[model samples]
Target chain A: MDIPSYQDMLAAHERIRPHIRLTPVLQSDHLNALSGARLFFKCENLQEPGAFKVRGATNAVFSLDRDRAAAGVATHSSGNHALCLSYAAGLRGIPCNVVMPHTAPEAKKDAVRRYGGTITECEPSTSSREETFARVQARTGSEFVHPYNDPRVIAGQGTCAKELIEQTGGLDIVTAPIGGGGMISGTCLTLAKLAPDTQVIAAEPEQADDAYRSFKAGQLIADDAPQTVADGLKVPLKDLTWHFVSNHVSDILTVSEQEIVDAMRLGWKYLRLVIEPSSAVPLAAILKNAERFKDKRVGVIITGGNVDLDRLPWTEGA
Target chain B: MDIPSYQDMLAAHERIRPHIRLTPVLQSDHLNALSGARLFFKCENLQEPGAFKVRGATNAVFSLDRDRAAAGVATHSSGNHALCLSYAAGLRGIPCNVVMPHTAPEAKKDAVRRYGGTITECEPSTSSREETFARVQARTGSEFVHPYNDPRVIAGQGTCAKELIEQTGGLDIVTAPIGGGGMISGTCLTLAKLAPDTQVIAAEPEQADDAYRSFKAGQLIADDAPQTVADGLKVPLKDLTWHFVSNHVSDILTVSEQEIVDAMRLGWKYLRLVIEPSSAVPLAAILKNAERFKDKRVGVIITGGNVDLDRLPWTEGA
Candidate 1:
């Protein structure tokens, strides 16, 4: 499998600039005081369709040849990526078919529908998802857009960290949540080329510590039955993602479910920004290990804000 | 009593430029779809202390004499204004006291404390609030900062509109909620001069539409029994505020409690920003009368985002 290089990531940024939003990097005095870190939050949570997934999705959609684009696009995602790809495809005047599991949050499903994507519900299993997506591709003759394994997608996601580095002078450490490891891998790739000394840390929930364990053991591991409030982090580690994580990532830190909830609440109470549990992992990790980040310039990628209001982490304050 | 002219408002913008945040102007496509009008949201909800009240408070704090600043500042408010003044006073190294009504939300009281303000609770009546505040001022020798009536405060409030007009080129109309009319008066003064063709409208909850009735009656009419989810808009219109509303305001529109709640939900669901009912009034009005503003470019001031999480509007959705 061919891996994307630093130059490819830079090229992808240029390719996706028109399709992707250069999301704002917000400075938080309150958050800075909380951890003693001069923190710059790359607010990907506020990106188009409320996630950084749009960057990769836009890049993938736009990179396709006119003939391929005309054939349409297909993907399987339970959350932000599905909606993002659908939205990006719709913008490019192409049809999108998303194979979302039945267990996916209603809010996400609604967003995908709103973006004019045809949805096919599958059982909550990788085999089921793959089989269903293949059927979708066969039925519609659409090109399958891999969520993260694809080099173009990884390079596209790297643009977020590129913008972060440009927006802030330089970050001492960059932290992002690792699920399928797309965001973190992209972030690490950008940081490696732009500022090699800057640490690239992957934050993951303890319940779903596949990336964390894999990084520590130097071998890919999959969390078969991950249990966490962060539904987005349930996807198991992939080989390409593991390769990116093993080399470029400096460390992987695990945060508790309670910590994720606390971070989400803090984002809402202090930042006045709604963030999903998956996005909270990095913040939770920072707060848990304040000593590691104190007096340093840290960048946190707020992955997404597509939270289900019904199942919100209201239990924290309760 | 001297009313703030458009010129005075511009001068206020100059005065507070160094101290206050020129808050972000965000366009909501989802709201535009629902409202018919292309809605530009001036996000004062993300302002310092999470409300537009900080604009006036900061101006008041900075404008005070050295002697007056040393003596300190005091006010009575149910929430945002008191906390805003407390924060502004804290910045200037001055003592801040808030004589809040006993009925004020705990979240509001907590915010005041977080900003380092001493709270003195009084009975939930105007006479009681005035009497308590007067006693506190007499005992502490702190300059009393009225929530809305003061000219300096009005000037500070006007700066928001001035900034909004500057950010949005020239809006066809500007809408803000009217409680004691501090923000609306400032908004009208700024728009009436800078964007003369811009319609300056006030959105009030139908349950607490004293300003709407008074606008029509051409006389000051207080709500004998005000009831609305928007706690900030319960106050009666003051003399100085009435003068501006009577003269410069194009019209006052009323929105139902349901509409206010729905608008607040939409703010969270679509914009992914938490907004208080008061902030949602303009949006509520827009949603209710989409035809009235067809093709018009509308500027809506989202006043605050300080709602209690325990009592989130999503509970109703559940």
Candidate 2:
């Protein structure tokens, strides 16, 4: 496995610039007062396909040589990455084949289909997802882009943090919610090279704290599945993402399901942002541990906004 | 009433630039495909207090002489204007008093209080609001800033359209949801001078179509307290707003309650914005009457985003 450097990140950024948005950085004085920290929300959620995953997906899709592009691209994701890759592939006039779990949000499934991706449904388990994706990849002979673990994908994701630092000028701390750690790894990769003095905090849901536990134990902990209101954070970190998380992250914080839901509502009311539970994890953690971030200029990465509006966390089982 | 001129709007733009966000203009390819119009959404919903009403309110609050400002500011409103005035007054550290109806959403009422604005509730009728407002003004000696009727407020609202046209370079048509006609009048005011070729269209709910009827009749028509999901657009156009609307507006379009609700959900699903039903009105009108705007660049001002999250239009009575 190769580690992508800052130079690779810069190259990937140029490769994907035409395909992704330089999503705006948002600030809420109301939210800043709530935690005694100035919060700069890097709104990757505003990306046309509604996620930061577009950067990575677009880079991976656009980087393929003409012959490889002709074969198309394939990926297995719980949600956003599948849709984003499909969007990028569609832009490039190529096929995108996605393997998604049966339990994935209906909204994400619809978005993937809207972007012209063909979906193969698998049982809601890691083994099933891997097996299904393998069969699809074998049949199509498409270039496999791992959701977060690929060097090109991580380098592509790094562009978001690079933009965040530039947009805000600088920040004392940068926090992002951790699922498979794609966003966090990207943050670490950028900060370690560009803004070494800045701190990187990874937030996790208490019910699905594999990343948190792994951070404390000094190793990658695997979780096939972990049920949480923050559906995006159910998966565990991959090896390449673990390399960055283990070396560059300053802290790992966890928050309760209720905290996540409360933060989600607060984001909608105060930020007027339609954010998912995963995007709320960093905010929930920040408010929960205010002292650590007090008086600091903090950048909170709003990873995605592809929420299942009908089945919001606050209205579970309604 | 002295009409606010294009020069007055320019002064208001400069006066309120520091206080208001030059809100972003967003475009959605999906929505454009659906409507066959290139829609430029001026996202005033992303304003700090979550509305374009802040533009007028900030101008009104800040324009007062020091001696008059010391007496503070007051207004009667259904929702957005009340909270926005409160937000503006809070910024200047003045006593902001507001007269609101009993039927206003809990969320808006809470926002007014959050900004330290004292709310005096009255029956949800024009007469009751005026009577209640008079009493409050008499007791507090606060300067009256009529939501749309005042020249200062109209001038301030015009800045939104000025920025919208500047941001998009130019548009063939500009559309906004009309309640008391503050936003529409502003669009008309700006375009009549800056972009005379640009047509201004006002959208209204079919259930509360006073503005549409008034446009057709070529005279002011009033709706005392019509019921609609777009709580902000229940009020009638005032004398000052009518001056601009009667002179510059090209057409008035109305949509059904169902159309409004569907557009609101589509905004959430596709735009991923937590927009109020009022903000969805223009989009609904455009889709319902697509042939009129086909292949043309249209600027749609998203009025506000201070929505009652728990009681979304789609989840009513859940």
lDDT per model, in order?
Answer: 0.86, 0.92
Model 2 root mean square deviation, Cα atoms: 1.1
Docking class of 2: medium
lDDT of 1: 0.86
lDDT (0-100) at residue A312 of candidate 1?
75
- TM-score computed on alpha carbons, candidate 1: 0.96
Clashing pairs in 1: none
Candidate 2 lDDT = 0.92
Query: How would you encode candidate 2's per-residue C-alpha lDDT over B1-318 as one tens digit per residue?
Result: 889899989999999999888777887888999999999998898899999999999999889999999999999999999999999999999999999999999999999999999999999999999999999999999999998888888889999999998899999999999999999888888889999999999999999999999889999988888999999999999888888889999999999999999999888877778899999999999999999999999999998999888788787765
Looking at model 2, the pairs that clash are: none
